[model samples]
Target: MTEKDPRYRRAASAVKRCVAGEVFLVPVAAGVADVMSLYVLNPTAEVIWDLLDEPRSLNEICEHIQQVTGEAGGHVREDCSNFLTQMERMGLVERA
Candidate 1:
């Protein structure tokens, strides 16, 4: 997906689970068992992860972040965009 695109959701091929206070993402595929690795989300990222339970536009996610953290809209948008980009690269998320 392009960096300008904000409509995304968690990829179906990955599994997400919350253990303790952290969120873990694991790939689900044959032969992945041996190479499987966990991707953990930080507190802020956890919030974004949950928000992505359904397909959502980047602007919508940033709006929720602003409401929850009271951060400036521009800052929240940038942070969320960056986080989404990273998650996409890891195959944890995909364009909706």
Candidate 2:
């Protein structure tokens, strides 16, 4: 993926599961993400997490969110981008 327009995928070292009604990402034992701590995904993050089941460009992700939520395109795009950046920083996702 190019630096300017990256595609994202869920990190191999991380595993996602639902506990009660909340979704969480936990690091596989002895995995890179183990040191990063368990992450409890918010609803927005959960949706993005599910979409990243397969590698996807940011625009594709935003489009899906917009379709599901019927929100303004520009706003949803911006928010989704920011959310992705945060997820990457936390070692939950990586460029594909």
Candidate 3:
């Protein structure tokens, strides 16, 4: 993933949950639609979200995924990268 805009930040009102093992997210601002969107995150995405409290570089996230998987996560690197790109575009995550 490339560097993101410094001005972008996660809205504190966002809500997320893992239901039936799939992740769901909703932007919880007033006047926003109540309908939540389901995001079927791959294992790599799951790892990335699990570490959201800390700002991590793309390489750092990939390493964490590899550690959890007991092997290099190159197979899912593109998938993870794409997921982050989408999340950034959606304002689901922000650069620190």
Point out where model 3 deviates above 4 Å.
Answer: 1-13, 31-33
Candidate 1 residue lDDT tens string, 1-96: 566755989887677677787788777776363235788777788888888889999988888889888888877888888899888997888988
Residues 23-70 of candidate 2 have per-residue lDDT tens digits of 888877574446357789888788899899999999889988888888
Stronger candidate by TM-score (1 vs 3)? 1
**TM-score of model 2 relative to the true fold?**
0.84
Provide the overall lDDT of each model, using Cα atoms, as 2-decimal numbers. Answer: 0.81, 0.85, 0.64
Error of 3 at 69 (Å): 1.2
lDDT: the better of candidates 1 and 3: 1
lDDT pick, better of 1 and 2: 2
How many clashes (backbone atoms < 3 Å, residues ≥3 apart in a chain or on different chains) does model 2 have?
0
TM-scores of the candidates are 0.80, 0.84, 0.68
Model 2 is weakest, by summed lDDT over 10 consecutive residues, at 27-36
